[model samples]
Target: MRWPFRIAMSTTAVMLFDQAVFAGQFLAGTFGALHTHRANATYSGIAVLVAAAAAVPLRWPGRGPLWPVLACLGLFGLIALQIVLGFQRLLTVHVPLGVAIIGLAAGLAVWSWRPDRVAA
Candidate 1:
């Protein structure tokens, strides 16, 4: 369960990083990059969803702490909202939210791999 969760979280984190890259390219005056960014945003959301699903078993059957499950779900919700904001051209909120999302995803991915955190 822990391995699955870790893998999913890591994947999600990477996807989020890719999102940032695409966004940067878009902002750098590459019109085509905007399309890539939009597509990657949806993919990143799906990755977050997969990570959240993987986290479920960590809390059930007394396998591990519940925080990861909650965190993943919260992150997914934020991503969903971020997608909406992006499509509506709301950069004021979207930019800050994206930064926060990347940070949170990275943190969760690192936490998932901590040796002491895994259940025996």
Candidate 2:
């Protein structure tokens, strides 16, 4: 129980940090610093993988934080797909997926800090 909540908060922090870095990447692209794109994508993929892995321990006994864990996994899947769509310049799916990731990650971040939420 304690582990899930702690891991959730930790991963949520990663999501928050990733969002910030994502915004910076946008800025970099705007200024023609395109070199950071691949680097950013690499780090973003790594962060998503780490978050997904952290979510595994959340499935221990008790109420089972299923949806959050699934969401993290789903986010990772969408990101992988997003990368492909992006590489193909399929802006239609890629853009919407990016927005979804932002909203989901932000929601998780806020949910993690809820005072009423208990670990045990």
Candidate 3:
């Protein structure tokens, strides 16, 4: 269960990083990159949802803390809002929110790998 959660978190973090790369390419005048970015945003959102699902068993049986579950849910909500902002071309909020999403995803991945902390 822990390993599954760790993998999910790591995958989500990587997806978020790829999202950033695509965004940068789009900003650099690559029109096709915007399409890729939008597609990856959906994938990233799915990945976060998967991570959240994985986080459930970690806490349900009292094998771990509940923060990861809550964090993943919160992150997913932010990603949902992010997609809306991007579609609206609201860069003022979208840009910073994207950064925060990546940070949170990466932090969760890192935390998932910490055996002691994950089980606590």
TM-score of each: 0.91, 0.66, 0.93
lDDT tens digits, residues 68-88, model 3? 999999999999999999999
Give a tens-digit lDDT track for model 1, residues 77-110: 9999999999899999999999999999999999
All models: lDDT?
0.89, 0.63, 0.92
Largest lDDT belongs to which candidate? Answer: 3
Q: Can you tell me which runs of candidate 2 are displaced by over 4 Å? A: 1-32, 61-63, 116-120
Model 2: per-residue Cα lDDT over 22-97, one tens digit each: 6466776654333455456556666656665665655654455777677777767776787788689887886777
In model 3, which runs have C-alpha deviations exceeding 4 angstroms? 117-120
User: For every candidate structure, what is the RMSD over all alpha carbons to the true structure, in angstroms?
Assistant: 1.8, 3.9, 1.9
Instruction: Please report, as a residue range, the 10-residue window in candidate 1 with the lowest summed lDDT.
Output: 111-120
Q: Candidate 1 vs candidate 3: which has greater lDDT?
A: 3
